[model samples]
Target: MNKNIKHILIILALFASAYNASAKDYLITDFGAKADAKTDNTAAIQKAIDECSAKGGGKVVVPGGEFASRMISLKSNINLHLEAGAKISAIANGAKYTSLVMGNEVQNVSVTGSGTLFGNGGKFTIGEEAPNRPYIIFFKNCKNVLVEDVHLLQSASWTLRLFGSEHVIVRGVSIYSHANLNNDGIDIDGKDIIITGCHIDSGDDAICLKSEDSTKRVTENITITNCIAASNCNLIKMGTGSIGGFKNISISNCSLRRATESPFHKWADKPDHYIGIPISGISGIALEIVDGGVLDQVSITNITMTGVQTPIFMRLGSRKNPTGSFKNVIISNITATSHSRMSSMIAGVPGFNIENVTLRDILINSQGGGTREDAERKVPENEKDYPENRIFGWTIPASGLYVRHASNINIDNFQVRLAAPDARPALYLDDVKQLKATNVKVDGEYIIDKAVYKANAVNTSVNQ
Candidate 1:
């Protein structure tokens, strides 16, 4: 070989050796750590992470034990693996646990294994009573991430939150929260994410896709499939915190159950506050393109839900500064049953209306009656305080589904059954243009109520 080629071969050999060394897995118990299940194991885990990072990247194995700690930080090229039977529990006291795990632009990182990460946060107190704190695991500005096979329990806030991340996968994880005040299971505020095969139960939204504020940093390409969400405020909700809008999202093959909160005791010191919000449903699937952004190309299909209030809700508004519009949305193949009253609304500002929205093959069974005379009594009450609130959309009575100030809307194969007799119509559309309802049935009757179509009527019909 030539002299230059020989030198290049030597350099290549050195680089290959370094890569092999960096990819080697490092054991945690080797660094003077005990998996005895009683000792404070935070230091040992941190030491293991430091050593693994220094070695250029590797797996830090947590052996079988109840390793108690908080805020476990992950570095690049590192995989924190908990072996089967390994239980890493967080300290119960708030002071003992760090609130969050700060990410440092790390890539190729994972927290995986059959073990469990139990946040013993049920013992902590928030507000007057105990409130769930933030996430048990938080990753910010990360890439190439994997969090699988972990059981997260009893979080005060969201169990796992991914913020500003890319190429992320969350699978086969179970998250549970019974306290229900602020317990959301997995909250995604990033881009290019897939969450599949997870079981989530919380007091609030089971899976919330959100953006903190409106900065035009859109969250896109999110796919959620084969997940079970139950006993949540909403099974899956998008944008109560949508400052920046969302795009290119799909959700399928999910089962949702509206978890019934245990009745509150009047004599108890702290009573649960049930605020009446539109999105506070058992299987409430909402897409609100509010906060000055555009929501486009969103689709939801093949959802089976029981014990839900409102199964579908979509609202678009420029609350203070209306920046964009909501267009090209579709919802199909949804089956829902509810004991609570169902309410859904789609509305926009005067100039900008929700456009190109479709609802198809929906079957709902509601126990609560629809749009009673007493429900319309709120109009006069709102006029007493703020009369302008009565002008926008308040004169329109509440219904199972309310569509106001929208255009190009279609509702096909929509059916609803009430448990009791004398139930009203299930479909309510008002102030909408270019609306079509084919094969729409309410209690096996092909009827279109004139009061629902009296607001802004244009080419509205129900085909038998």
Candidate 2:
């Protein structure tokens, strides 16, 4: 053999050996960590993590049992693997670490395995006037992160959140946080993130995406797929927190439903609060770019939803300035059932029309109790207000779909049904331009009251 080739082969072998040597596993129990829930294992667990990080990083194994602990910090190149039937129960006090598990500026970190992280949320105060409670898992300024196969329960705030992180994968996790205030399942405020094959039941938004930062941050290259979201609030929501822009997002194969839980049975507080909703008074899928952020190039498909006030909501609002815009959105293959009072709203503020939106292969079944009085009522722009479906205050003019201040909008293969009596039009368009609706049907056989109602619309066509 050539001597040069032999030298290269020997160098590769040494590198592999060193890599394997650095990736050692450290058991937390070996470092004076107790498995009994009665004992405080915070110091012992932190010691184990510090020692493991000192050893060039590796797995910090928490074996099966109940470990009562405060916040645990994770370091670089560490995998915190919880064994089956293992639980890490949070100590019911102070906001020291701000979360049960936290990572900051770390690389190659992961938390995996069939275990549970319970936050004991009853110990928390439960109103918006209170301070923001900590999440179950909160990480920031990290990279190459993974969270898989874990169950998170009863967070005082959001269940999981990532801010300013990259290359994150969260899969096969179950999050249930409906017992308290701001109980969102997951909030991602970063780039290159994938959340797939997860189940989330929450009182707030499930799978929320935010780009809220003082300085500009771009939330790009994100994908969410094959997830089940049960929520009392919006099932899938992006941006009422858009200080930065969002780009290149795709969401597919998702299920959205009202959470099957009750406040009396689940929470048992003094004043009854609903933990979950049998029918959500919120939208199923909501997107907004209100706080001076550009939102563009989003695609959502294959969505199934039920028991929502509105099936979809899209808004390019003006609550803050620079006055951001939204464009180039595509929605396809959506099936939804809703107790719609205000219709599925899609509108941009004046002078900032949401541009180039396409909806294809959409089917909606809605409870239609809208009267002619409600239909004739003019909808408010509410540009400076917080962006929400109910923020408009009253019912919209349409029973099925309502759109305003848009351009180049296409609605194809769309159908709607009124489950109850509705005097409103099936679809309403106002201040729209270059709109087209093909193969659109409403009320089974009718198209407008039967067709569409248009006002100040230009260059529009509808073929039933």
lDDT of 2 by residue, 128-155 (tens): 4457477899889998788999999998
lDDT of each candidate versus the true structure: 0.66, 0.82
Task: Kindly report which residue pairs in candidate 2 clash with one another.
Answer: 447-450, 447-451, 448-451, 448-452
The clash count for each model shown is: 5, 4
Task: Give the runs in model 1 whose Cα sits over 4 Å from its true position.
Answer: 1-24, 36-38, 96-102, 128-132, 260-281, 318-323, 371-400, 444-453
Please write out the lDDT profile of model 1 over residues 1-464, one tens digit for every residue.
95324533453353334334436567767866676656666777888888888978777887887776666777877778888988777665545443434355887777888988776656566432444364677888887777888888876556788888877788899887765356778888888788889998776678888877446687888888899987546678776666677899889999887544522111112212112222224445767766656688998999988755566766665554544678998999988875444345566656678899999898876553434542443222111121111123322243346676788988888776655532333555556788887876556332234324335667777663
Task: Identify the runs in model 2 with alpha carbons over 4 angstroms from their true place.
Answer: 1-24, 262-278, 444-450
TM-score against truth, every candidate: 0.83, 0.91
Which candidate number maximizes lDDT? 2
Alpha carbon lDDT at 312, candidate 1: 71
